[model samples]
Target chain A: MTAIPVQPIVSMRRVEKIYRQGDSVVHAVDQVDIDIFPGEFTVLSGPSGSGKTTILNLTGALDNVTRGDIHVEGRKLQDMSRTETSRFRRDRVGFVFQAYNLIPVLTAFENAELILSIQGVPRTERSARVRDLFHAVGLDGLEHRRPSAMSGGQQQRVAIVRAIVTNPAIVLADEPTANVDSRTAATILDIMERLNREMGNTFLFSSHDPQVIARAHRVISMQDGRVVGDERRDGNS
Target chain B: MLILMAFRNLWRNTRRTAITLFSIGFGLMLSLIFTGIGDSGYGRLIEGASRMGMGHVALIPRGYLDTPSIDKRFDVPSDLIGRIQVMSRVTAVRERITGQAMVATANDSAGAAFMAIDPGTETPETLYFMDFLESGALFDPKNRIGIVIGRNMADRLRVDIGGKVVYTLTDVQGEIISGLARVSGIFRTGVLQVDNYFVLLPIDTLRDLIGYTSREVTHLAVFLEDHAASRSIRSRIQACVDEIPGAEAVTWRDAMPDIAGLIAMDQSSNYLFQLIIFLLISAGILNTILMSVLERKREFGILLAVGISPLRLFSLIMLEAGWLCIFGLIAGLLLTAPVYGYLHSTGIDLTAMFTEKPDVGGVLFDPTIHADLRPISLAVILTVAAALILLSGIYPAWKASRVMPVEAIQSA
Candidate 1:
């Protein structure tokens, strides 16, 4: 009998990104290769300036690679135009940032359902999905409150719900817990883990927090714009 | 949802928004009020000039306007005058003999233009003699050869009311003629040229002096109920008058191109003033929108990263500007309405500004200035302000939309 190999959801081969400042050229993201698969709660762990956020940006098509190929869901991101790249990000991926950047004018429910709205989902369906996600993230009664009225942990929970409400193939979080308290960070990680397990959603996060590193099922460590280690813990470590 | 967001965002900085609105609203009100006053003042001046001596339309011998002499006189039959008086829109028609002459008293003499008017046939509303009568009565039927002279001319000739004066001029056959008349009234029109040069006498007496027949006259002035209808009335009267030999009709616009030019210049300057006001308002709006865009750089980046397109962001910014302009427009109209009402009803007294009635051209303007707002002018001003506000938003919106999401998010 022959074995069938499953393809990775995101593929990067020899990706490089360079920046020119005045008369100096710097390699912000050097030659590197990685693959992210489905239903994995993975962490990219590195010190400052290790190119972790750059790699995540490249995968999300928010930034372009200088000299290599990047494929998200088996399609080459480099081949897309700027508009197409934006559409790709809109349709295929969700993002969580460190600042909990919800639109100030929108309520919690509105912030969560914005992506579904953008996708032209009917009003009823969008409301139902946002309500369910809000419930899952323990934000059921705070739906009408704006970000300014919510606590830091509650805001992050809303951001998480926003990221996953569209049910994209992956959620890329850049330092998502960097601004929250330790207890709030733990709560955020627990919600992410449960969502990853139950809804079969993939999460790729960049963080140096030890608590985040300890909860990840897979940790890819990087140093000086290059991957130094890849470790997988067995059976939900 | 976008509109709601834009509206709410405007009030996030309440002080800034209030200041911007005040600037736009105040500027617009000032522009509208000034424009209304200017238009009303010009309208009064034109109407006054037309009614003073030059009627809205006039009939003259074809070549007489170019060179005024006794030889260029034409006969206007009484039947033609009766026909013109019965025409629609023609209020009155009066015949006059205008000629240059030398007027002399016992002590002094000066060159003057004499207009011989038939006082019995002329309308009191169209005659300047009664309005400016400084002393003595207007021409009396008891005194057939009575004359009315401007005060400046009276001063030049050193004559008073009831004083005897002699007027001399050349007649139709190249013969010099002279006539003796008593000054029945002395009038003072505020217009310097009219006061300095004009002398009035009975038309029949002047005709007898100049050797003209009974029906012959230099010109006939036609008055109209609506001054604005002058051009069309002139054209209608011209069609009939042209059949008479060497007869032509002229509208006041053609008779006084300098006054028409003055009106055009006033209108153009009003438009320029409006432009300046709108530009100032646009600058205020542009500054507010640009600062809002700058402060929301990170918010815009997050929006882009979450799938909102740059074009959508641009529209959002422009929507904000549109809301602000609409608020400002409503506020301005509301604020200006009562002030305009007051000015239109009661008028502004320019007596404090000018000690005497000012004469523009040959027309004297009253000291009380009333404002009149035309609907077309109001619509034009509002439309221009709205357009300028929208135009001011484009650049800031474009700048906001063109920002790269990643760099924006990374920057503080």
Candidate 2:
């Protein structure tokens, strides 16, 4: 008998995203089907305008799917109302931006605690969870530092902590390593992989950087708004 | 978190925020000074009109204020006078006879309106003869024919402080009468109407000359501790008049409608000016807030993507406006207090600005301007300012709320 397969945390079915440029319709994302499984560290690698970030956005419920369905943690994103969609994003998926967009007014711990606070987690528990995560992510002493005071790599690490604090269905990072140096990018990839291994957290990244793509257990390649290749590999190939 | 982020975001662009704050503060300070000056100036004009002999509240023969002459006289109701003198806000009650007369010096003659008074029976603080006496002495109680005249009348009549003059008028029986009097004092009021046309006589002397009994006078003038209390006090005095017969109570506004009209007109113009200034400042502030919001589109996107609701984002913007209003009001008060202090105290002389004498509808204003900011006026102004500033933020806040995370993030 065949082994049973674990349910995928996120699944997209032939999704198409269309855009209107006044006089013309552009297929920004077309004929794309993807499944991001639990504990999978995956990369959607492509050149500019290749719809990698678009796919990540669709999975994160940050953008609407045009013609097909997207199920994140088994909740249909397009069918969600505005409030429900926001709650879905809040409770399910976490996002890490390429620019390390930490709220400048908040300290690192506070930044990581923001989602939990929004979820109405008690203050002491929020503090406990944020502190433990800060320690686990190698950001032990910088919990109180604002984004402006930290190095770029350290800021990205805090951003990762912010993304994974809820153990969400997937952490969608759009070009997460683009702005950092190679060594810092390596460190970020290491921390992200460690998060997946130790916590069973799922992550989906959109990056054209070969170094970042090389560390992912699965690589989905796209060009001209179409998926052209899918390669699954053993760890750290 | 919303408020914290809002206040911190304001400081992120410190120079821009400071510049915007300065604009708000400067506008508010200017408004306070303008309004303060208008209040004090109107008060000064009103008191000046009152002292010119309207009093704050007055009781006269039923038709005296409408058409006045020495013939329309009333007996001094001692009971009514005593009742009013003891009224809570009453400062003093004065008896006076006002009539048009002719004063002829040995060398010259001019028409004058004479007011007969018993010395020390009026608001001493506002008595023109007592306060602005330029030379000589006030009337001696023993001398029945002593009088005081203004400097311009003295000049027009070609008389010295002690010069002899004759006053002529028609009394109650419609008979012409003349009495000889010595000028005991001369006062300069800097008001052309008062200085050129007014004369003060002893009550007994005028009564005897005009063939009136001791208790009969043309008018009874009631003074108060505060002139602004005139309306309410007038009602109280009117209620007393209703109890008695053959008299009517009138406020200075009714007694001197020209002065009241002038003040109302001036205040309306001042309000219009303030409204214009408020609109301009609101526009500048609105634009500043919009630019601040537009610049942070992507930041707002990051927030929205992280699950901050649109309503929360809108509140964050409004909180920013509230904070801006608070800071601006504080800054404005800091700038205004000292200037209002100096203006209210030492006052700023406006003599040079007076190409002509500072008279409006026969009333003279002192050249120096004083500020009189009421506490309620300050609260009203601040509340209005805060409302406008907050109103200025609504559109920007709505715009912030409607931000699309994908487009906004990609736009960056």
Candidate 3:
């Protein structure tokens, strides 16, 4: 009867973000407190207006916190400059969006290499990593295929590989299967799940789909900028 | 690799890229032609003027430059010519006796200025004179009172070679001394001022006619091995003259201030045109890059999502612009060579642009114009155009960097 360790990879304390539109202020994310733990499949489930994406943004350090302390892997998000934030994102965070936004001009291989290239990873290491990533995503021979040439499932898988190629601590997937068929969506999910289990990487997915939520070990449900439910499933599956 | 990426991406949107490149190329061509024509015309004018009596540097009596009259004509020592001859870089020195005179040819008589010089040393400039005879030789150094008249002056006086002309002028003593001169050679330099106003005679004879000793001369013209060394050599020569009484050394530029000013003005105008061209090309390139960034918003977002730094993204976009500009530069150079070559060979006629003939740097040039087609000019223009295009991409690259990955992906 040992307790499972709740090691927080990302922590937010009373964070608030407001958007100015015309004369009124809209609260995109209100004063909230949360912690996302390492090596956990966490789902943020909410309706369209539930500030799910805003929370994801604050977690990823893509946007500045309006009025609170945010620590990612023990690094203070509010204290980082714009360049520092970018470096943090580069070294620590990976993002997969609903659109599977692969660079159209690059093939699957080149798309993955873009991240490592900017990181100044040597060519030999990059090649080996890209090769391994392609094989892991079950796209071994499709490295030369451009986004337009690949199917929706294949493109999403490419994006997943692109995100994880830098060996980031967490993968933030924002409605990653929104544009794919059910069959393709399930395959994408399977690939992402295998990556999380094998790499021991944290996965924070923002989705309202029941299928997506069912796969996560921990679920945090939100409504009106507030978490309404937080649940964790045992290892029994 | 960045350049390769940029080139490939630009080709993805060929029409837009071509238009951008066209703007750059057109600007480059315009600059080349304008600069080429300007440099050539001005260069030739200076060369032609230098070939005349000026010879890069001129020496005159100390106060004679301020007021060049008969009274200021000082007695230069006999050693002056020998000293100037042996000076470093002195290619040739010609002594001339200049004075005002009233002369009556066979048919017409008019008050005019006279320059007496050795015919042997006058060959550098005398060839351009309208009165120069293609058929007959110039007056013998032994001919004391022989003269050469301009075609216009000849027409006015109705005199030809071997014809006797009477010249009357007062000496420095204000006593009218009349002399008879024979026309040795008829000339036409195609310049109206020199042809109509000034006549050449033997230096010795003119000295005798003006009652001047051999030590007296109005000016000495010193030609140099390299005209560009004129300023430094003029300084050295000026130092040498400081040791001599009543002597001063001045460059041809000092002798012709209006001509020197015209050259300076043309150079400034050339720089202005080059600046305008740089701005024009930069704007065109920036517009193209902005459009490309706008068109590929999602792509940039994808790059950002995958951990590409904003600065790296900025570099990629700018690298793309640099490639486009470089392509345009190469294409421009390729197209410009033949066009410049053709212009250089056949020359452009300025008659269509000017009412009469354009006078540049005191030399009246004909309507036919030439251009200098040097590789250095080409390289300079290309480098500048490339720099402008690269600089123009910064703003568009910044705009591209501002694109949020979520918005871009969702919008796409």
| Each candidate's clash count | 0, 0, 11
TM-score of each: 0.80, 0.86, 0.86
DockQ-derived CAPRI band for the predicted complex in model 2 = medium
Better of 1 and 2 by DockQ: 2
In model 3, the runs with Cα more than 4 Å from the true position are A1-6, A235-237, B1-4, B62-65, B70-94, B122-127, B130-132, B141-146, B166-180, B207-217, B222-252, B261-282, B349-362, B373-388, B401-412
lDDT of each: 0.86, 0.86, 0.78
User: Is candidate 1 or 3 superior in lDDT?
Assistant: 1
- lDDT of candidate 1 at residue B48, scale 0 to 100: 72
Candidate 2 residue-wise lDDT, B208-255, digit = tens: 888999999888888888788898988998898785577878898899
**B268-288 per-residue lDDT for model 3 (tens digits):** 989897898788778778888
**How well does candidate 1 score on lDDT at residue A227?**
85
Model 2 chain B weakest lDDT span, ten residues long: B120-129
